[model samples]
Target chain A: MSTTAVVTGLGVVSPNGLGIKDFWAATKSGKSGIGRITRFDPSPYPARLAGEIPGFVAEDHLPNRLLPQTDRMTQLALVAADWALADAGVTPAELPEFDMGVVTASHSGGFEFGQGELKKLWSLGSQHVSAYQSFAWFYAVNSGQISIRNGMKGPSGVVVSDQAGGLDAIAQARRQIRKGTALIVSGGVEAPVCPWGWVAQLAGNRLSTSDEPARAYLPFDAEACGHVPGEGGAILVLEAAEAARRRGAKVYGEIAGYGATIDPRPGSGGEPGLRRALETALADAGVRPGEVDVVFADAAAIPELDRAEADAINAVFGPGGVPVTAPKTMTGRLYSGAAPLDLASAFLAMADGLIPPTVNTEPSPEYGLDLVTAQPRPAEIRTALVLARGQGGFNSALVVRAAD
Target chain B: MATKEFTLDDLKRILREGAGADESVDLDGDILDTDFEELGYESLALLETGGRIEREFGITLDDDVLTDARTPRALIAAVNALLGAGAAA
Candidate 1:
């Protein structure tokens, strides 16, 4: 009797769209959310473009009590959690508060809030800083606040691994469900589109400096430059298989398997680490390479890294044997929130039987993989392989299969 | 750079911004007599409003004013004194 964990609900706060309906429409239409940075003036900055969520006034979503205390990431997380519970048809009155939990992934939490307070301290002295800065800036603050806000008091935790943290958080959610928790709120949120965030990213040397929006952030092209950093996230509800069935909930899919690996120099060392992660995920899911219907490539836009990932797919699945896509091309990369967004799209693809198009991208033939581009492709998507790689060599893969 | 000196109107505007001010109370009358709690201010609202004023005026405000001062009249006096001290300095 295997107790599988199923994705019962999803809430998304993305630059592409706010709620699941809009997100699906935008994703299906391959809408481009990238635009000039507006939160702060980017005239002095080299990296000019971003996937900003416009007109998102925080006060509209949060209570007055939670507003002053929350950072942008936590605020996004809270609203997404509310929507997820609603979509799951979960009423707190129906279940014991201690049976549920929350785990969120964020590589950098409240960078926008912390940077503002730090500026105030330096220029105006410490007295001008908000008292909320202390608890709000910590990465784990999302997990803490979401759990408290909804009374999800089961075992909870936070993942700090880079972009892969998103899938890792969901993986942890599944493990928690198997360990006797009835339900878990699992996903990632990032709001790093701030002045300080841009400045910090400039130091990474991987940012796209193209002034033209259409010409920038190409992931697998002959003229592929670096990626445009973007902000957005998705939160999903993971429920135990039996519990979800008992409630007659509409399950989106199963989080069948998750695998993560550390690669110091994947491109250099025959990149066996990424292959191992993919192989482990397939094995864990009890799936064959032929069973995977589509592949969500990391699409980092770094030439060598992208090629390494392409090569990794060729080694494992035999030269782009499966249809692959990089939907992050539309939203840039959401960092810690990136992979869960991919997972959400994967689930939607399975449910709708149509894989969303990889916007603003056309992969070159040298990649040897069948990259879906320009438009959405209708397919029998049974199993999806979503991949993510963080800045410092964190590689992860998650396999999501359609629920019966 | 010194910002423009604020007026009573500016003070009211800041207080109004801090407030939902949805209640049927007189927002134009002497706010000193009017309770901020009636205008949707919690304990942190005054401090946040005070912070905004200090930044707008490029002046240093006494931190204690956030806790000790409860009325708009008291905050206005404090702001004027800080602006005067800043100009004098």
Candidate 2:
């Protein structure tokens, strides 16, 4: 609506891959990151599988100064932030302190940190509790630490509304850019694969308990049981499109428009809010249903939720018109990190001219949408619509135009 | 009424343990000038320590005690002062 804000740089730390290059390669190859839950002991629970990042060493990316100050979630965000800034070709010293900012989306702030402190309290008693628990576990820690580390005093905020927050964050970041901020580091990450995080997710009762890692999170499939929770997220560098051009930065794609609404809970027919979000996003993008070349679906994997989303897409793009893909089948649902990673995937898809497959998904008659499955498809993608819904009643849609 | 005093070592232990089980902390640093933030002590650590102090001395420590008692020496002083005041009342 204001100065065009494009995702100029991207950094991803996902289960299937470490960075954008590796992630997209694994995504196109249809590799699965799901495995028996090793982050914590999942033996007690039926859902023992997760899409966890393999062999993530914190010392590799983060500095020694941040070692004591961060939780695993914050560390991942910080590392991704570094990669994003580097990818954007903007060094910290060049930017004005008040011009750059950070906004992060999160579902669970630091369950793993809290879990460790809780263990100390229960086992070793009060004297052994760690002070780091206070800073590390809060939901907004990533934003605070990132801002502090980057010296960005610009207007910033954190959204804890749920997974839909990822898209919402981009929407908010674009607003900041439009309001005259030069660069905003936005996106999200989660490290909820730990025992406490897993137990909390287990209480939600939506995870796939299947022993098979490959098919654990097949969104839009008749055999879809439920989603596997995963780790990692992408931190994106959103800059004014013109500024990126002036700086000769590589523009991934512009976030044309975004829409956000509430679920209004169980009994609502037509799921009007979701439909409205998608329609609003398309309209804001100045893009018609036909103009939307591809869609990155929320892919809830819960039959009714998945159907609701498909029906929403059908209502907007017409049934089977827009090619839909849920590449999350490989990495599982990263909660607040999911849609942003999907947005990252959309950026890659727009750049590479390929729609990555939804790993193990096989489209059935149940969902009347063109679900990209099995293998990557070569296509000319222009405008891509990304959809997301939070467990706590938040529905959001974002539209991205191809970089070319 | 009897007032209890905490040793400098005990206060140092609280500050060290508050940082969690990781890197080293400055235990023998300047008390008046050094803030808790220098010790990598965030608000959560202060809150945990405040609770522990309350439980240990059986006296209620206000949340602002950390900001007020920034260093190990000052913290021990704050604990004894709070305990003395509690015994008086």
Candidate 3:
């Protein structure tokens, strides 16, 4: 028998807000974090709008002496990790360092620090560059920094498979717990607002260039174009159900099932790989299709991609249409942090028995999915399926059940 | 441009701006003793300030320079050494 992995504590540092309270309030109110870029000058780029985290002072959370050694992505992760640890009431001094681990996901690594270092190396000599630049911009920097700060000496790793990697990290953490690790801090954080990262994303033809924030990302709508990029999202604190129960921890939800599939050819409309992923996840969770209460879709906002997702949901839930929504439209896309945030939102929604609205969606009956829009709907949500697909062809789905 | 000597006040002012310190704080005396958390400066802000200083003065600072130069007076001396190195080059 497999050990169930339950989310004992939750923390978020997203564009929506800093902590779970603020994030939940803002998300329920249908607020959009997308706005003009403040991190760097976007004069040259085609897309000017993004879901940048506002008023994040890293020093408020990190210590004074260790500030120079960590990157912005790491700083964000540390903040969220601290909150999760506190919420779980597990202090570093109280717990055994060997039992706790950290697994994080990053899509673009540390773009801001990397951009700064590259600029310095180009204009000035190599000797002028700070030594901290060597490790700050790497994808694994967040996991490394978090582990070092909290004295978490257990297994630490990073996933680099883009948006899908967030959900994959949670799945990996669940595996860790079953393998005898006590706790796992699993999530993702992204800081891709730098000019170079934006330029790289522009080449993908999936970025929405709409000047208006409301109209920027409209998934499943006829006016769909593409997704807007965002920064700063994370959720942490997962433990074995038995271990958490022994510790008298507050269980948020259970990571019941996880399934992932890749379409060899992306953007072809050739096959619905998402259907297989959804079906496989339900089978893994031992739940039937009719038992799924809600779905958190990928909602890429490209016309073809949206249609594929819509078709997948219809095929899974049948013609009755399951209540589906995509909150990514509000925060743009967090890349590595996208699905973890989605999973967190799903867990909260199931716990609270409320379905969050899909922001900025027009009324369209043709899509065939019941999209909750404009207002929160009360529902007895027991199970939620969170879906995410990366830029190239990576597709991931996770099934989370409410802890009774 | 001729090698310009950076005064203690100049370095303090740059650090204060980079750290997002309040305007009321004494640039010369308060900056040296100010903690990183109190000044709202993190790794990214420090790098940005360091980059700006290197570009403006045409000088490169080593890791030891940042570690050793905690006070405004010490930073000014390090800047002077870098400026001297640039002049010799």
Candidate 4:
């Protein structure tokens, strides 16, 4: 068999919780983190609510030196990477730097950092801008910074498919592992809650304007509106199964399979890419539709997107064939961080035998999904599929199975 | 010639604000001749420090001059040279 890629460690920074322990606890209990935006004044904006990670003082998690040089997104990612490496019990000094790699996803590269520099350039003179802005605002800086910090000299790259980028980056890491790299640090973390980022997201026209926290980001609901944008995400450590077994590391699950596709041009008489992405992932994993224990849905929360996702699920696994959950309803859609967070939650669910609830959604029966909502459900979940779609027609699917 | 001399104290302050000292290093020591890299300030940090110095002193240092000044003493000398030349001009 080809080298199997397995997840050995997870580090989460979510609106509901900072690490895996608190995040999983809150997720399984159906606690919602969506609230009024406190990072900046949202009174001027239509969509005023978001899932911001509360009480996160970057200085508490990182050294003061990094504070001036990094943006919030990079700082959060660096912390997540540290936590993941510590959780895996792997020391960079002990491992061969050439055997390790990093692959992460990013949607918007340091919007707040760029905006701040731009403000200085416009108000003051060009000379007032900080030189750090050159690299801080680049999308690939997360991967570069993590690689430099860990001394990982192996294959490294960043994916930019928006929300789908999370899975795409993980899948890329898995590919590297299969190609003989011993370990890869993968996943994404995003912090786009600043004024500049909010305006950019507002341009998408897919954010909930509802001021009520509980009802704002209802996905797959009769009153479905739109997703609430959020900050933070999860970072995971992926290692080759053989290497993990040799080290006697605790394996969370295997990154069994992944598939992605792009929708055709709007005027093209072609089908949407979600169904194909699902079918391809199932085939890639050598898994039948019936074997999947649960699905962590994309849950865009828009009526048309929800219907399309529901239709795709029905066509693939049959209506109500498998239980579906949108745990993101609690933390809001994390953009590049969304799918990886779902992947992490899937592993946690498998370990605990509890499917986390999709909070605040009264799944409209029209979707034909056995939607898990309002409360956590106990199940024998050995296999899971995670789905994510990005704006302007990007679709990705990943299947993770419990490792023996 | 210049209004006031740019002392080692000013360089220390700028260095701390620009890149911050490494946890193991001390900024208050008598180490004016120490290499910037050993003191935990890399090229980028020095570049930022140079920018601040230019803005604060109202005198621009050449990019080459900044890159060549790898120690606190060298950087201080470079800034003082620019200040004297600006005053003369």
lDDT per model vs. reference: 0.84, 0.84, 0.82, 0.92
If both were scored by TM-score, which would come out higher, candidate 1 or candidate 2? 2
Q: List the candidates' TM-scores in order.
A: 0.84, 0.85, 0.83, 0.98
lDDT of 2 by residue, A62-127 (tens): 655466557788988998888888888889777899999998998988888888889989997765
Better model by DockQ: candidate 2 vs candidate 3: 2
Q: lDDT of candidate 2 vs native?
A: 0.84
| Candidate 1: tens digits of C-alpha lDDT, residues A1-404 | 56899999898888888888888889988997888998889999989999887767778877655776677888888988888889999986568988999988988778988998899899988767876676789999999998987888898999998798998899999989989999999999999888888878888888999977767888878778999888888999999989999999999999988889988564485453677788889899999999999999889888887888898888888986999998888888899888988988998888788989887776888888888998999999989999988888888899999987
True C-alpha contacts between chains kept, each model in order: 0.03, 0.22, 0.00, 0.53
- Candidate 3, residues A207-309, lDDT tens digits: the string is 9888899998888887888889998787679998998899898888899898888875745756867888888898999989889999998888888788788
Question: What does the lDDT come to for candidate 1?
Answer: 0.84
Cα lDDT for residue A185, model 1?
94
Model 3 TM: 0.83
> What ordering of candidates by DockQ runs from best to worst?
4, 2, 1, 3
Which residue ranges in model 4 land beyond 4 Å of their true spot? none
A best-first ranking of the candidates according to their TM-score comes to 4, 2, 1, 3
